[model samples]
Structure formats: C-alpha cells, structure tokens
Target: MLEKKLHSLSLNQIQIEDMFWKEYMELVRNHVIPYQWEALNDRIKEAEPSYCIQNFRVAAKLEEGSFQGMVFQDSDVYKWLEAVAYSLMWHPDEKLEQTADETIDLIAAAQQPDGYLDTYYIINGLEKRFTNLMDHHELYCLGHMVEAAVAYYKATGKRKFLDVAIAYADCAAEHLGTEEGKIPGYPGHEVAEMALVALYEVTGEERHLNLAKYFIDQRGQEPLFFNEECKKNDNKCFWDDTYMQKQYYQAGKPVREQEKAEGHAVRAVYLYSGMAEVASATEDAELFKVCEKIWDNIVKKQMYVTGAIGATEHGEAFSFDYDLPNDTVYAETCAAIGLIFFARRMFEITKDSKYTDIMERALFNGVISGMSLDGKNFFYVNPLEVNPEACEKDYFKRHVKPVRQKWFGCACCPPNVARLLSSIGGYAFECSEDAIYMNLFVGGQIEAALNGKKNRFHVETQYPWEGTVKIKVENQEDSSFTYAVRIPGWCQNYELTINGVKPEYYVEKGYAILNHVWKNGDEILLKMDMPVTLVEANPRVREDIGKVAVMRGPVVYCLEEIDNQDQLQEIYLEENPVFTETFEKDLLKGVVTLKTQGKRLSEKNWGEETLYRPYRGRTYEKQELTFIPYYAWTNRGIGEMTVWVRI
Candidate 1:
C-alpha cells in the first residue's frame, strides 16, 4: 500500500569497501568466480562433471560430443559470466574480463540461425525446441543470457554480449506469445521475466518489455500454456491430476488469482519478482496489489525465522501455511537468493521498509549460509536445525546436509552466491534527485547525481556486530538534500547526531530522515543499542511453540554441538539468563560470539526410554552456553545446530 517508488543505485555508483562484505566480495572474485569457471569447463577432477563448456562447443559444431550435463547446463556459464560482470564493475580485472569475453564468444558461436542460443536445443535439435517447454529450460537459459549480457554491458560497456542476448530475445518475441501463428508458451523456470525487464531497461526496446509482460499475462490462463504445449508434443500434462500439480511451476492459476505461496520455491519467487517488475513498469495498480498480497502470504505465514522461504524438501516447495518445520526444512540457497530478487523488486514498486528488512535478513543469515568462509564449499539446502546422524540416517531429512559440499552437478548455489555477493553494492543504497536512502549500513562510498549535480559520501561502520555508524557528506557547502538512514526492524533504541549535535528528527517507515544542507566534512553519527533479544514465531507456527531464537541486531545466533554438549535437544534456556557478548578476533574469521547461562536437562532421570512415558520431575544442571552466528555454524566441522531452543 505504500506509494513511493524506488530507484536502486547503479552497481558502479556504490562501492563497498566494508570490513565484512568486502572480504566476501573478494572471496568471490579471487576464489568462487575462478573456481566456478574451472568447474564449468569440466577441469575440476574432484568435482562433479558439469559439461557446460563442452556442451557449448558441441552446439557450436566446434567439437563433436553429446551433451552430458543437465538440460540447463548452459545456464552455469551464463551465471558465472554474470558474476564476473558484477565483479569487474568495481574490482576491474583484465584477466577476468578477457576470460568472460572468450566465454561469450563461445556462446555466440553456439547460436543457431534466426538467433536461438540454447545449447540443449542447438545440439539436440531445433525441431525439439518449444516442444518440451515444460522442462527444456530454453527460456530459462535465455533469461540468464540476457541477465549476463546486461551486467556485462553495464560493467564494461561492451556491446558484443548484449547484441547476442538481444538477438535471442528478438527470436523469442517472434516465436512465443499469443499472436497468430505464434505459440503461447512461458518458462518452466522463471527469471526471463525480470531479465527481459533488465534488457528493456538497457535497450529501451518496447518489445522486450511487452514480451515480458506477455509471458506474465499468458501464464495460468483458462487453457494453461504449459498443458497445451505438453499435449501438443505428446508429453504428459505438467498438471497431472494424479501426482504433480501446475502449482509446482506456479502456473495453477493466473498470478493475480494465486493468493498463497506455492509450487517450486525458486520458480515462484522468480516469477513473482518478474510480475513485480512488469507491474512497476506498466503502473498497473491491480498487478501491484497482487504483489502485495503474495508478499504477505510468503513473509507473514511461510518464511522461516532465518528468512528462508521454502518449507518442504519434496519438490523444494512451500507446504501448508504455518507449516515451517525446522529439522526437515529445505530452505534452498537459490530460493533465498530469489527472495532477495523478489524483495528488491517489491521495494522498487512500493518503497516499503518491510521489503528491505526481509532482504537484509536473508542476506545476513540464510542466503550467506550457502557459502563457507573458504568460499569453496557451499550448501544447496540450508536447514534451520542440523543433526548429523538424522541427516544421514533419516530419509525425510536426507536433503539437509551437515556440511557444505565441494560441488554439485547442478552447481547453482555456489555461483548464485557469487553473483549476489559480487553485485551486492546495488542492494545497499538507493537515491533520488534530492534524497539518499541508506538501505544497508555497510562501510562504503557512494557517488551519485542529485539535482543535476554530482554528490559523494563516505560511510564507516562495523555493522551487524557493532551498532555505531559514521557517515560524512563530501558535497559542496551550498548543496542540500535529505539523508535517510534505515533503522533496522530489529533495533529498538537508537540515537543520531549531526555535526556532534543531537537533533529532533522524524522517522518515516523505519527510516530516520534528516533534511540538511550538506557540506564537505559534515559528519553524522548513528548509535544503535545492540542487545541479545529472544524472538518467538507467530502462534500459528506450531513447530516453534514455547521456544525462542537468540538475535542481536540483524544476525540470528544458533547453538552448535561444537560449542554446546552433545544431545542438543537436552539444552534448555534459563528463566533469567544473562548474556555477555565478546568479540573473538580469530574465530570464524572474526565474529562476535554470544555467551549465556542455560541448563542441560537430565535425559537419564526419566523412568524409561519408552515412547509414551509419564514425565516426573526432571533434574537440570547449569551449563554455560555459546551461540555463534547462524551463517557461521557448519564452518567448523558441523555436527548439530539449533536456533530455537527450549525456554
């Protein structure tokens, strides 16, 4: 219901030189990006065979071999290029840029006449194209292609890759949609919608925007396009009455009619994010309302405490409302990254603080949990609770891995994390003609244009661990603008001072706004009180009754078996537990570990190890407990981890 529109800063405009995020970004550039490139080329002998580059060569007729990876193997190359593009934006490396350019050349060679570029279809057969649109991922690959092309153009102002992407998009426009002699089809996996929007933003092509809008509109119509396409090709109906449902692809009904979060979590969020973009561009109030309703459904009822979206491991989809199980959870890393995409789009349309809050929450905890400190290992499924034996022995908990793996054949999360972290500066702040919104309080420098004049500002902070932030305006003395600092949803008490003088200010939608004439060396200091608070889920969430998760600032803290004793379930919170915080400079690459007093319940005091035993009074022994950031849990040889403990 909010009215203000958002305009995110350009990737080059905001530079992150932060103590925390800069390290992660460097890790992506130095380790993850190069590592993923090696993986795509099938050079990593220890990792799974991706066959990404080989497939391109086969499709291009430069080599003779069969495609050996997933139908979407081509996306791996595209995602890596996108990550490299974002990486080169601020940390320009000629070697990385050359590598990406060469990869793009291989991709360009793989394109078929009339501008079709999917390696699966190019090598497999163009006759097979669009026939299996339900699962072939043709549009999905094109989506990544367009996204990478846009980033590359923005990063290096290179038109070669963008030209390739536009050619393919034009082909899509000619083939798909509801026009006469055109097939009415949409993507099995989304991303094309938003990617097309990005293309339109760069090229100012009305067809690209219209094509994206057409895809959104044609989906889930009376005759579902997916069903019709499947029936035409003798493929089984995607919405089989017996097993899989159309909701699995978020195509059960028209997007506006679909009120609840359903289907594959990543697909659903990507599709919704695209819908938000189209709604924003078209200024469609009804479509905007759909976004708001769906956002409410996801964030209010379905989202996990750690900001992960999906609930069930089956199909990696959401379960029933308030059915957020902690132990058997499938909070896919890709889905959390998709949530950030969705939230950012929602924020662009409504300029709501709630959307930014979710983005920050997911970034600091669930999303980053996908990557390890070393930046080589990654988790595809980020579960809230971990039990090593249960993860190994229990079939229901099979998707939850106790430790990050070296690689996967799919290889989605590692590169997805890399792309997000590399381009993270775009998410930190947004600016208008005369106002600046500090979205995330990370140490950075922003160079932007306001009122036809260039302005610069420098921010210094030890955020997420320490609560104090100092920002200095570096504009000319006569320049004036409104500065807005986001007061995080978790913060309860804070103080702000300008030029060392406290001033009365008004908070609008979680942002403390100060309108002032900026001058060089004008300093603003913000102090937020950091306290260990207990967070409880809504009463509707049956899994988290009479339990609390420890939180300080934006980070969610968890108890791991490495710190606590074995048998994690026996741990209980003390009635009036006192928590003390200390900075461990050498632990987990320097984090603030929280220490508290708790009790370990005596499991042996029970009468017997029976399923149904009447509980007598149980004995408890005091134990000192240590909690680390949830994102840093499995870095030290994972065993057991729990966020919500007995209170």
Candidate 2:
C-alpha cells in the first residue's frame, strides 16, 4: 500500500536526500568539488607513487616507497573522498564521482597480490598490518571508503568505486577475520563493520557481507582486543589514557549483553546501526530485539532534550542512563549524526513512530544544531546549557559550554549532512506501489512512477517554522490513491482540506489516511498548529526536571545572558508573559526573538548570609528577556546561555 502515493521517502528524504545531501553536493560543486577534481587531475598528471602494483583498469598505479613518514592520514582521506563520491551518486555529481573513480583506482593499485591495500605497506615501508589500532584509525577509514563506494554504486548503477571497495573488502575477508589464520576483525574503533555492510549492498557478494558480519559477530568474543601496547612501546602510545589503555578494543560479551553503549559514541552508533541493517537483511530477530532494547534505553534515559546522544566528555561516550547532566553533557555532533543513522534504520525495521520521532527531533534540533545556519561553522559538542561566566572559573568544564565552532579535527558532520541532504528524496517515500505516507513537511517537488502511472507532487510549505503544507498533485491520468500524513504527537489539532473543502480522515494513533480518487492539479492542504511548546525531560534525566525548554516548529529556542539582566540560572520566564517576535531580514537574514518578563533571583542574598539556605524567596525585579533560537546563541560575545530554564 505504501507504494501508491507516499513512501517513507519524505522522512529521511527531505533531510538526508534533499536538504542535506543536495546542499552538501552543491557546496562541493561550488568549492570542494572543484578542488577535489583539480587534485585528482593533478594526481593523474603526476601518476602518484610510481607503479607499485598494477590495479584496476580505471586506476593509476602508485609509486613504490614514497609515503613512509605519513601517519596514515592519507588512508583516512580516501574515506572522506569515498563519502564525497557516494554523496555524488544519488545526488548525481559526475565530475566529483569521476575524480573519486580515479582515487578508487589509485587505492586498488596499492593493494598487494593477496588483497592487502595500504600505500604505506605496499609502497613505502613494511608489515604494519593491524599493528596500531589506536593511532591508525585504519579500519575505520577503510570502512567509510567502502561504504561510500557501495552507496555510489547503488545510486548510480556504476561500479568504478565499487570495484575498489570490493578489492579492499576481499582483502579483509582473506586476512582480517575471526576464523583461524585470519586476524580478528574488529576496528580499534567500530565503523568499518557498518561501512562493510554498506559496501556489501553493491557487491551482493556474500563474502563482503560475511566479513562485515564476522566483524560484528566477533566483537566481545575472546580476546577483547589485541593489545598493541608493546607495539607502541608504551611511550607515545595511541590511546594514552590509562583507562582507555586497559579497554578491550572489541568487547567479549554477547552483543545483546553489550547494553551500555561503549567506546566512542560515533563508533558505537555506527556499528550498532550497521548491525541493525544486517539483522534486517539477514532476518536476525535476536539482533533486532537487541537494537530495540538499546534504542529504548537511549531515548528513555540518555538522549538530550535536543535529541543529542552521548553524555560523557571522557571519550565523548555514553554515560549511565538518565544521567544527562546538561552543563557537563558531551553530546557530540557525530553522535547525533549517528543517532540519525540508528534511528532511521529502526524506522525501516519496525515502521514505528517512536524511531521516526527521534529521527525528526535529531534531524532538526540536534543534528542540524551541529551545523551553523549558514552551512559552514559546526559545533563538535552541542551542550544544552552554559554559564559563560562560570567558564572563566572552571576552564576545563568550560569545554562543555554550548557554542557554535568553526570546525572539528574529525569533521564528519559537514559531509554527513551533505550526503544526508543529497539523498533526502529517498527518505520522503518508500513503496511497493499501493499507499504513500508524508513523513516530513519540506517544500519540494517530486516525480515518481507508480503502478504503471506517473505521479508528481509539488509540496509548498514554510515548515519547521509554520505548520502549513499545501501539496499540488499531478498525475498522467485520473486515478485513485491513498495518502497518509503524520500527525505529530505535539500538535493538539490536525486539520486537512481537499480542494478547499474541509475534510477529516478520522485520525487514529498518529497517522491520518486520506484515500480518494485524484485528478490533475488536485490539491491537498494540511495544517498542524505550531504553538510554543514547553517540553520537559522525564524525571530520570535529573538535569531537566523543574526546567522547561521551548520549541516552536522543530527549532528549540534559548535565552542568552546578553538578552537577560542576570545570569541565565537566576532568571525565569514569567508564566503567561506577553511574547512578540519579528523576522529581522537585514543583518542576520532572519531573527526570531522572544521578549518575556523574568524575575532574577538575588545572588546578593546568598553573599550576605553566612549560613546558606538552599531555598530563598524570589528576589530581584522582573526583567524583560529576549530569547532566540538555541542555534543563534554565543554569536553575541559568549555570555551565560540557557537552553532550558526554570519555569
């Protein structure tokens, strides 16, 4: 039934396929794409490395023994390139993919006869095979490349990148596996497994899938991890922290028992999501249940009000459940990106609202929260609250302070957002040809062939700000189709009209179905009320109780100390305060400011009394404060900022 009108495509399709990936691709076409193409052309011109080994026909051979001192940073670049390439696939940027094709060939040529591929090993030095996990990020790098290649192949029906990915995956299958004579396949970090599965989709080659499966299956098996301390000589060790030093690169417990998300948050979620996809593809019910368990535990207790996950600064890792302390929360940008991946997979697995709910929340508030509104600067850590004044006091703790930053060393969000946006159309709808569901409201045009007929839809809306969606539908011929639209959990009323006439589909649960005969130029208008909604985290999240966060149409709003008289903690938005906002077109494009009366608690009272009473009567005069979108904070010269404030 989903095949008829709307597919789950509108879901991720708007964000990943349309908005994110497409924007990123354009960004590339504008800046990075040209640079990459030039770089590839240069490489082809120079014939890098000098014929170390003969590779695929499309590839240029690398010279023998040129890159000896490099710390495998070159290896990681391939992954980024691969991501770039695949991002070009569904988004269809030929020039970039062609450059990627050349790079893929270069990678293939670097491979050893037995299937090993590493320029350092084959060209420059020797025998550094899985010898350094902590510093290398080798497997993690390859995994991304493989994934990018596979995605590119699937999207474009092209195999240039795929061949290189297969060759590398084949090499891993040969040597780095759990079976005897094979090295156990667990990345020092855990992304390659997922990447392999993504790679496997193109090959449909069982070995690649099995190799990916083996990495996941072999996790927590026996040797938690192959300790490379001796190899790093203990001094200048990759994982310097003693606690991290003692950790098992791969855990030894059954995957289900591996409940608390361990390791780096990005690695953990990427690995888990890959495992979920494998489970679905393989029909492994146990893995699916395990995924659900982990998902439930995360959203219920660990995720931030912004839908950001991961809570500790130690490894940018997950802390205990419900231990989401806002000031100290290390909600990494990559973790939120990973959450999107995990949540989307969960959406496909169960077709449930909960997963998409998190997906939507993260996509708008947390994930995009990582990127600046202008599409450049990104925040590596998206903390909920910050006392900019306190940051001067506790310097280290100040890292948790929420602010928009230029870029991170491990800049994953930019490309991740890019690829997600480019492929967003796919997320909007999914179908086997019977029914369609509108998951997200983003203004866009789509043309899809349905049931031997061509159907097109042009959705016009100012969504994520206003809740109105008007869809103009066109078909080759008059026909009957069923369209399902999601009724948000937050909205009090859902209204729909067909051909300017008021109509209700008899909503149940959260899905409203409109089944009807359609004609060319027919219109469907749906409006969801967008009132300023105050949300509170569950009691388990002790950091959020007694504090309220305001969200208007997916964008979370916050109050900066700049806009308030006292520090953020001492201020509160008066109940039933008159609020007014206007879009300031100049000098910031668009500005949404909220003016509300707030009474600041007296800090002087505490200073005067030697004996401190924890509770005191509300002091200080009521002050008017202007609240802006949380994404807009810190631009006004780093002052105390509060995302969630006392009611």
Candidate 3:
C-alpha cells in the first residue's frame, strides 16, 4: 500500500534519509528558519503608530504593502509549525515542539472573533477587512491562517489553532462567499483554496472542502475582480483591464477553461496548486490534465536555472516560454515556494519521481536562496543576475536588484519559506499501510506500525552537501518488505549495495528498485558523485544562452559583484571555471565554490554609445572570481552583483 501510494518517490533508504534531514531539512532548520523569524520580528517590532509597518527592505526604508501583507499573516505561524513538525522528522526534540505550540497559540490570539484577521492593517484597524480585498489581501490572510491551523494540527495533533483556522474560514464562507447580500468575488489572492484543502484533509469536513472548491470555481467567473475594483474606484483604480485580459486570470471564464499561468507570480502558482489538489480529490481528470500540462510548461519552458519560476517582472508573473532574463528575473521566492507546492501536488497526483526531483531542486537553490546566510535578511525576489549599479541607476528596477532585506513591504517570501520548511516532512514521505516508501534521505529514526506491530527504522546519511548514505532497520528482528528508491535525473552513474554486495540491477539515472525480504541488522548504502555541472539555460532563453549557472549536488552557485570588482560586462570566462570546494568557517557550511579566470578592461573610459553605432566586443587581462551558492549572496556587504556575469 505504501509503495503504491508513493510509487513515484520510491527513493533508496539512504538517499531519502540524506535528502530529508541532512540537505533539505537542515537548510530549512538552520537557514530558512532564522530569516523568516527575523522578518516576523521586523513586522512585530517596526509597526508605525498603529500600523503594522514593513518595507521592501531595511534601509530602502520604503513601506509598500499589498498581497505581501497577507503572506506575513501565515509567516507568523507557519514556520514555527514547520519547525515543530520537523523536530519529529529526524529525531524528536521537546524544545522544537514547544516553540511550535507557542507560535500557534500566538496566532490564535491574534485573530479576532468576527473572523476578520490580518496583523498588518488590523494592527491599524479592523475596519480595513473586506474593504480592500483587491490589495489589502484580507481573504489571502485568512487563507494562510487556515493553512497554518491545518498544518499545526497535522504536525502536533493539537486543534486549538485549527479551531481558529476554522473560525476564520467560517467568516470567509459566511461573509464573502455568497453574493445574496454582499459583493460577488474571490480573493485577489489565491491561498484560500489551498488552505481549505488542507483543512478538509485534517478534519474530513466537506464545508471546508466545498468552500475551497467554491474559491477555485468562482475565480475567472462573472463580475471580474478588476470590474469590482473599477466599480469601487469609479475608474481611478490602478488596474489595466487589457493587461488583466491577457493575463492568466480569466475572471471571465471558469477555472476549467483557464490554461496559462497569469496574474501575480505567487498567486498564480498557488492557485494552480490548489486546483491540482481539487482535481486530485474530485478525480477530475480534465482538471488534473490541465494541471499536469501547466506543470510541464513550467518545468520544461518557464523554470529558472535555480528551479525558480515566473519570469516577467511585470506583475512578477510568468510570461511566454523561454522569455527568461537573468538580471530582470522576478523569480519571487513565494512563487518558487508555490512551485514546490504545485510540484508536490502533481507528484502526489501522478506518483512520479520526476516531481520529487523538481521538488528537491526548488527546495535547495530556488527556495533556500530567498533567505540570507545569516538568516536575518531576505531576498523577496531571487534574480539569477544582479547589477548593483543598474539597481541604483534604474528606477524601473523592481526585478533587477542586489542584497537581501530585513523585511519586505511586500514580504511574502519570508513566511512562505517558514511554513514550507517547518512542514518539510510532509514532502519527504507518504504512508498508507504494509509497504514503506522512502522519498528522501536524512539521518534519523521513524516509528510506524507494520503488520499490527510497532517497528522502527534507523536511517543515517550525508545528503545534499554530500552523497554518501547508510540505512539500518531497528526493533524488528526479521520481516519481508520492499523499499523503492528514486533515481535522480542528474545522477549519471550510481551504485547501491546491501551488506557490501552490489545489487544486480544498476542504479540508473531515472530508476533503481530494491525489493527483498528484510531482517534485523540489515543495512544498505548508496554512493554517487555529484559532478560539477554547468547548466546552460534553454536556447530560447536568449538572456542566458552564453552564460551558465554552476550547480553541484543540490545547490546552484552564482558570482556576485562584491566577489568581483570589475563591471560584469567587462569580464569573460575563457573556459569552464575551476571547481574549488570551500567552507565558510561560520555561515554556509560544507559547500563548493567555483572559481574562474576572466578578463576586464583596466581603462574606465568607455561610456555611452551612439544611437546606432556598431559595437565592438573587446576585453583583456585575467582576474579571479568565485561563485558561491546563489542562496548565499548579499551576506557580505552589498556591491555591484550579477549572477550571469559576462561569459
């Protein structure tokens, strides 16, 4: 039953454990956790007079809040919940669980009785609820709250917060759902459907599920949100209906007809993920097919080299296929987190290892990159390239920028990562009955019931940071079972062994099966070399054709301007850069840094270009530059930075 349930993520015992606790969860625990907390602290501590104030950055000092405001509502509770649930994943720790409980309790207290919730504007006043769903993100906030409660309940078996989630959900259902007396609309955001699905999973409550379905179905149908906005503003609202029409949001068509990704990057992906869930639950093959089709379009054509999605800076949305611009890549962290959610759901729907493969990709580079190395600062938008100078010179620079921030005025990434990592365990494995399937590898022990008896499995490994792994069974002296392991698309030549005896079938890049009768003291080990890989963006991704992003194991690396003083255009790599693995004594641990020899002009004389002058490509002299994991940028002082430095 377990094998069939997780038929797709059938990873070896060692790989599953290593990826889970070592690479994936540790990145969440050590790095992502701290940054999210810092953002939350910024939100709690920096509110002006009565407003819950937050800026796009610490020193940018500009307070611009919108849907990002709603994201923080979830951040307040989600990350703590993730940490709490994670404590049990590798090994149980009492302190982690307590922290999780405390955070959830605070979230419940933060909500008011009428179900009008949102910490940002609510800190200023509750009158703002439902008034500005177009931008204030009230429903979006409620959506996140529902998600947190369901997660907390699942992770800790406590429903105190779940009740709060339900109350907020009830408010949404009662107040805004039906148009009998009020306006007819859906969240300008897309979290409610996803959260409602989670609530349904936890309580088996149909109202919650029906409401979730309602949100998905209501979208793109009648009285468009923009139309409502226009009616509210008497035509002064910022929306351009023409833009909305071209966008993925069909406000005119039912969800079953909406095909392309559109609107806000984060919202679009989240909505798609929720739709995937709805389709999976209802067994709506048509909807599920659309979900898979969108998934293919994203991974094959829309995804970033860092596993990030959503290309266009306008609306921070996904544009045409291969329209990837490194420096201008919006690559919103919430969108990447959404990509993980969407990918995971698709994996669940199809039980495909490829989904897990992409899941691991998003988790390591695209996902973790949102948080700074010290864990305090964050990048709401994880661009593949950064031009510190252009960031200052160009005011239109929403997508291209440098350095991490204390908080975002539109700060959704911080809390999204928090909740995602805190609940990272759910993405690691699945359980049904008899057969046990290992999805990821991490050193830990898990207790489960098999054949009506209690049993334990002790797994140990060095994962993302390294590839070696080991696994051992505990408690049960003898038994018969099957452990299906995933073969990564990246792994070229791999080997698996049991008790030093190699398995007859080779561990190919896409598959490896280990089916056998098991006993106590049995062991398995997997060893693979994560060769230095230079990945060029697809040919159609014109911006990245000549450039390459360095990736080893699970982390993707980039060269920032601070690490190289010369302007990016002046530098050019003569050959593939040399791989020099190094460890930052304190910050990012057990890492590889790729170094390169490049050329730069000594003269600082070349300036402007004639309107139609023929440009010349010239360069000289060799210099040293290092590429650290994209997740580790801006930790040092911010300067001119570019992930896609020339060459």
Choose the strongest candidate by TM-score.
1
Whole-model lDDT values for every prediction: 0.88, 0.63, 0.65
Q: What are the per-residue Cα lDDT tens digits for candidate 2 across 1-647?
A: 11112234322123232333344445644654343334323333432321212222222243222442234434334545655644554355667666666666666555566655565544434476666554466676567667676666665567766776677677767667656876664666667777776666555777777877777777666555444323443424434454544332424365766665655677778878878877876777787778888788788877887888878887777767788877777788778878887877776655565666677788777776666545545577787788765555776676664456543334455556545644555655554365566666656776655555667777887666568888888777876766767777667875789999976575534667777777899899888887777787777677777888888766788887676744678777676656665555452335556666677766674665467566756677677777787766666566777788887
Q: Which tens-of-lDDT digit does each residue in 1-647 have in candidate 3?
A: 11124422112222234433445456566665544555455533542111122311211223334333443444444534544454444445677667666666556556676755566554555565566565556677677667766655654577787887788888778876656876556777777788788788778989888888888777766656656755775544344634655244435567777666656678888888888878877767887777777778788888887889878777777778788877777888888898888877776655677887888888887888887655556677887766677777876675565777766655566666666655564566554455454556556665555545555677776666667767676765666555556667777766788888986553333446566666777777778777777777777878876776667876787776767774666666656566666655454544556776766754444546534435565447778777777777777777655656556
Candidate 2 — worst ten consecutive residues by lDDT sum?
Answer: 50-59
Model 1, range 154-248, lDDT digits (tens) per residue?
99998999999999999998898777998888898999999999999999999999999998988899798877877788888534772448888
Candidate 1, residue 61: CA error in Å?
1.2
TM-score to native of every candidate shown: 0.97, 0.83, 0.83
| lDDT accuracy of residue 190 in candidate 2 | 69
Error of 2 at 632 (Å): 3.1
Q: Considering every candidate listed, which one attains the maximal lDDT?
A: 1
Tell me each candidate's RMSD, in Å, in order.
1.7, 5.6, 5.8
Pairs clashing within candidate 1 = none
Better of 1 and 3 by TM-score: 1
Ranking by TM-score: 1, 2, 3
